[model samples]
Target: MTIKSLGNPYDGDVDLRHGLACNCSDCADDAGHRMKAVSARDQRTRMSTDDMLDRAVESAIVRSMFGHNELSRRSFAKMLGGTTLAAALASVLPIDKVKAAILDEIGTPEKTDLSVGFVPITCATPIIMAEPLGFYQRYGLNVEVVKTAGWAVARDKSLNGEYDASHMLTPMPLAITLGAGSTATPFLMPAVENINGQAIVLHNDHRDKHEDVSTWRGLTFGVPFEYSMHNFLLRYYVAEAGLDPDRDIQIRVVPPPEMVANLRAGNIDGFLSPDPFNQRAVWEEIGFIHILTKDIWEGHPCCAFACSQAFAETYPNTYGNLLKAIIDATQYASDSANRSEIAEAIAPTNYLNQPVPVIEQVLTGRFADGLGNVRDEPNRIDFDPFPWHSMGVWILTQMKRWGYIEGDIDYAAVAEQVYLAADCGKVMADLGLEVPAETYKSHVIMGKTFDPAEPEAYVESFAIRRT
Candidate 1:
């Protein structure tokens, strides 16, 4: 007689509801025990050896329990606790308290003796300072801040694994991970470092024709880096004015301070730079301030905390600590009382390569926004620039349109791997932070509003943006 096959013995079977299946290798090997269990439950005194055994079922249950037992975490409370406001009066809050909170959740940071790269600070300088400031070390990482020539070098090193993670240009992590400039990586950028400190520096000679907003030409501008987020914003904003950026004007790459020299020397017509250069440019009479980068893509995600696919997978805890450190720095930066120290901290030649006055203007957001609006107001960088996936997805779409990725790529699925919001939250919660909503897009920053729901539409809305 032909034997009838049993279909998935433990799958939704009523008789098997009380029993685990014989899927365990150990159970399968124990034929004698299998026979005993089968015989014990037999309708007849004896059963065929072919009948499945209960010993096999018990083993499966045991293995499952063993698997679940391997899931682990450091305590969450230890990771998130900080008293920046409450302990502000103390001579030293000794970051250890915050570090302890982070470690309680993550155990230890991932990259010890890590050589992380950071660009010159405009706004995105803290990720570099956080290390020597003893923040990352306090959280259990022995980090070294390596300065690259600029954003492109930092990004290339990160991709080559010469550096663990970089204080990358807003789009570098996205572009590289999407396989834009090279091979695809599952890059991880867990938290916001800083934003709203960028500006469009006008030439010392050319008057900003806000009067002719639609057709202001003769601008050969300086971009900090060719493919940096600044380039993207310039493109989108120019497009909004119904101008073809590629055809209408000239775009060139120059370092921040070099912008003034280039403009003064007439090397370039104008430049977009971040502080202290932007601030100094205005204060030192280098140029008429054209616009704040914040004014263009207000609340735009500027710099992100990025790691490699290899680093993220291997050392999630370390990555989590890195996020906590950046968040802690943000909290410090946000307090009105802490502004002076933050400026001084980032100013020292050890960090941003700028003067305290320049760094202070940036931290304080005291720079002229170039639209007859001198914003001596709240810090513009958003601390909880969440729904990081939304940021990446938007970036991915821009990348794809620009031919950064070749074939059809799933931006949604890919973004999930890079940002790691779940881990970011865990670190925040562990440090006693109330997690903010993961945002898809931030519309208004420094009193600006973006249509968060439709970034693509917004991108398209810019009459000046190029295809």
Candidate 2:
């Protein structure tokens, strides 16, 4: 039987969950209710996607009006008849408008004033510049972008609700969701803030050992966090060079703001870190850019805009507005014409706390590589807000490869849950920006192609994995 063949709830024949089984007392007494039971799969196939969404919206509203008491709702529906109750409610409340608002997420925000955390680095360009550039204000939000010391603080604040949202590394949300580094709080990454905006920097003292990775055996490195692309990519880069990252080298978790200082103090030999720290090292004449992470993996995801699942559900409209603001700012930062302007906006002490020239060189992609010659790479750091699901799967594979996460991971399910690609696509389409037709695609890293389909094989293919 199809849903269309079933009696409408509005007509007071409310048996949405009941089937034609004769054991039930209600079904046994009702002679006319002996029709074949409609399977859940059949009901789903009979309804269009839009129809399902509309029904869900309607159901939520009805449940909310009855204080989510199923017994009260069913009794009220029986007493007043669903049509009469719906009409009476619609007369008093803007039912259709409310439904549209919920469906499109165009309603006014639940909470306007919010605190968002960020590390003062170029990876947080979109999240930081959005405040100065009026993107948040455009969406009717008063956001305070807090300067955090590091990723750990950001993760803690986000988990504890001290931050309504935060700027996080790409792998952070995945790790947070999996409870790898922190308590498993379901996190959502709706938009990636920047891509290809990181590099490996060696102390200027290592200039003689630059061209060769095999020569570097007992060096120490600093990445912002364990669950960061910096750590994973650094490990991948060195593992390919016949060096076990865990044993051959010592990696310490140093915050982005402290990375340059550590390199200056000789605490760490080099770092695979986010800009403007990497750029700042060159600015301080302490380190040289060994290789842009773009050279490792072109268009790799770096930092992202993230919040908890509870926050997104509790303040959906607010979350929607925030995401729109982020995506808007990200697209604005993507344009090369606006790079210098953005550099000036986010370079102040309250933002990146760096010299304008330093930030300008990183944003404009034209700067000295700290080795005497100047280079121009326009895609050195670019902003694209799309959170590709394949990117999540790749991070998960790295986590599994290094034994950060243990056995039996459903890679695609976890990626889909945390990445929120469908929600991002909706926002991108609303903004009239180009959205990718598919979220899962193949990625090539360091001359190796990573297939999201065969993740276990990909992990097993690595000879240096902890697993």
Candidate 3:
């Protein structure tokens, strides 16, 4: 809500907007009169939101100190009302000086040494490459890229402040912020690390079933997390074929590393996961690639660079530097010429912990599909740091479609608040990358158009929505 929403909080002829108490017929008349007198003094002198909030705080402190007790303080404030007390405080208190002191330490880094948590997947390539490629150090940062066990651990570490930032799925920050699968916290996704890097892999025996999704009704599949693009996209793919995801099939949350083992042990038939695990499974002769996520949504975001909103506000300089490093690394990774070198650099024991060739195949987009067929697709996986706000809206639509979130949602507000598109655009523009002017972009998924402007209608148009 806007500051104007505080209207009618108290009954009086007082003009709260200009912080004046008067028994006038029209508050706007009084405000205009005062503004004319003030404008004659200085046109540039104006009250800011910070100044107003600080004045409120000072007023509370003064009331608490002078009143007889807590009940007496409440009675005193209620007796005078908002406008009267505000005017009384403005006469007695030095509000502007207090506001200036409160805001004195802004726009500087509170901490320098920091840790960033990431899962060992190609989706986190931008975050991982930032350290070795000197992007982090170039921006006056000492960053430690910690490889976590899974998304859960990464989320926990970030929530507990063990890591200053984290590599997260595009939807994790939204889910965390909404308290969908965790406690509510204001999270921010400043940049998307990689897009279209995931694929669906099935056993070799069921290769024919991949063509006809309806034939795979009773099959069990795996995804990396409950609030993941893999799960949502997989469900969309299957449900489009007239199969219910909740009843017609079972989708279990399995870490990317254990997907192949789960398939080999007959625990799951296939998994929609990130590479180099998908490439690893194929190289080990366990599973064959069924479809790449790019085939579903060519430029879909898979992972993001996320941090709590509190951290960003507390360390503005450090957060900007971090965004700079990530955006620079993403631009470097987006080029096709740098794929091989990146594969070699990240496919070590400390990083992805997989064979270099497997990582190479994933990065280069040329691989054996485990069905005795070699494929060459250059855009199999790509890196673009722009966290389009439309993508956030779409993810929330899916969350509502599958019952992950409930009730009415302000889709645009949530998307705009959580996804740092404006900040990302600034970084991208500084790096000489093409930045789009519009915050929302329309896309087609499974042959259905999703208009970000009307997310609710898009969710309702679905035949399989839980809502």
Candidate 4:
């Protein structure tokens, strides 16, 4: 059976008889146990084999009643024990009949084999590792994680349906949906593969100018794509240093794999590219790590698993299983304990095509900075599958600020439509992972607060913006 069939056991509808304001000791105690159950369930790295179909039925019933509100479900569970609740729910709904119907639909994949594209970088770790680590297999998918040369190629292939789904930059889906760089095509980003896995590297020759951005006015830098966090972050970083990113410095589009070679050839002074490219630069002794992107904006999203809306609608079952596989691998990759194994799994030529040591340094966050210092910062890169609506709003704000998009835009509506946070929350909940209560929230980037509620005001506050 597909992994999606094994729904979240800890989630269900809450009893409406009791209000949320209730602070009774019995309710409080039950709430505490509910929280603990969720915590323990999240700790398990894999799904349980026992009672899988039954759990799916229960989960579907609970989710249908409660939606994404876990607190209500917890309160309901606290008020009534699981057995009583199940019996009550069964009395009203045809639980066994529903379970049988779901069972009949579970294993039948609309498309068993598929092509998923990814750029060869650590940012695509979850997508690449899912193939070798058997996550796709676990979800009844035969996936080929094809390694593409760059983001543009990946985008083109995805647009033409050459790729069933592709590892995309966080902004790519929004851009595609809005027809920023291509024809207007509805795209959906259900999950983010990596966050903060990018770094700004400077050529060894410019080591002295690293501390002073003002002195390096004529230097050229490379970003993976125009619609990328690397480009946005680079522009933001330099603009913060009082340099006009458009006029003072040159920004070029170089693919991730070619970044090290370009740096070695002096084709560019530096780049804010994805690892292990940054780590590869350090390994080659041609560049030094100036700063990790995490330092620029902690927990900022980087790469994501995105597909055209048509693909999802056409092959609903395949799409569901595909999302589960990606999210499952992503959660597994989130643990630091699995970094080395994942690094090894994805480092071979067919995937990232980098040395294991370099990949390990990027994954483990313990590496030489090429400036004669080894640093340890474990959150340098992380895997989180939830594609936050706030993140999409922030990307939209950046797009507006830099003139990539124009005219009146409904930031919240676009974000909600494209990011697919609701779908991600459902999948995450099914996997017994914690889901955020809200899709949009404020973010602090380089000590600057970005309120999603006032995106236009935030854009206006930027001193160095195109709009």
Candidate 3, residues 36-131, lDDT tens digits: the string is 333221245433444323433343344335421223444555699856866776688776665455335222245546789999999999888765
Error of 1 at 351 (Å): 1.5
Better of 2 and 4 by lDDT: 2
Task: List the candidates ranked by lDDT, beginning with the highest.
Answer: 2, 4, 3, 1
CA lDDT for candidate 1:
0.57
- 10 residues in a row with least lDDT, candidate 1: 68-77
Q: Write the per-residue lDDT of candidate 1 for residues 1-467, one digit (tens) a residue.
A: 11111112222111111111332333345434334333234424322322322222222232222221111111111132223322431334443344345346446444445667877765565675464333553455545666566776777798888888888766776677666666777677777666666777775556646445455465687888755667767766665576666777788878664766777788887666666677777666767667767666656677767778788778777666666667766655556565665565455444566667766767766656444567774654434524367666666656544444555566667777776777777667766777766535445533435544555564554444333
Best TM-score goes to which candidate? 4
Any runs in candidate 3 off by more than 4 Å, and if so which? 1-109
Better of 3 and 4 by TM-score: 4
lDDT of the structure predicted as candidate 2: 0.83
RMSD of each: 20.5, 19.0, 21.5, 13.6
- TM-score of each model, paired residue for residue: 0.71, 0.78, 0.77, 0.79
Model 1, C-alpha of 193: deviation from truth (Å): 1.0
Measured with C-alpha atoms, the lDDT of residue 144 in candidate 2 is: 75
Query: Could you tell me how far off, in angstroms, the CA of residue 123 lies in candidate 4 after the best superposition?
Result: 0.6
CA lDDT, candidate 4, residue 60 = 46
Better of 1 and 2 by TM-score: 2
| Residue 122 accuracy (lDDT) in model 4 | 91
Off by over 4 Å in 2: 1-105
Each candidate: what lDDT? 0.57, 0.83, 0.78, 0.82
**Model 2 compared with the native: what TM-score?**
0.78
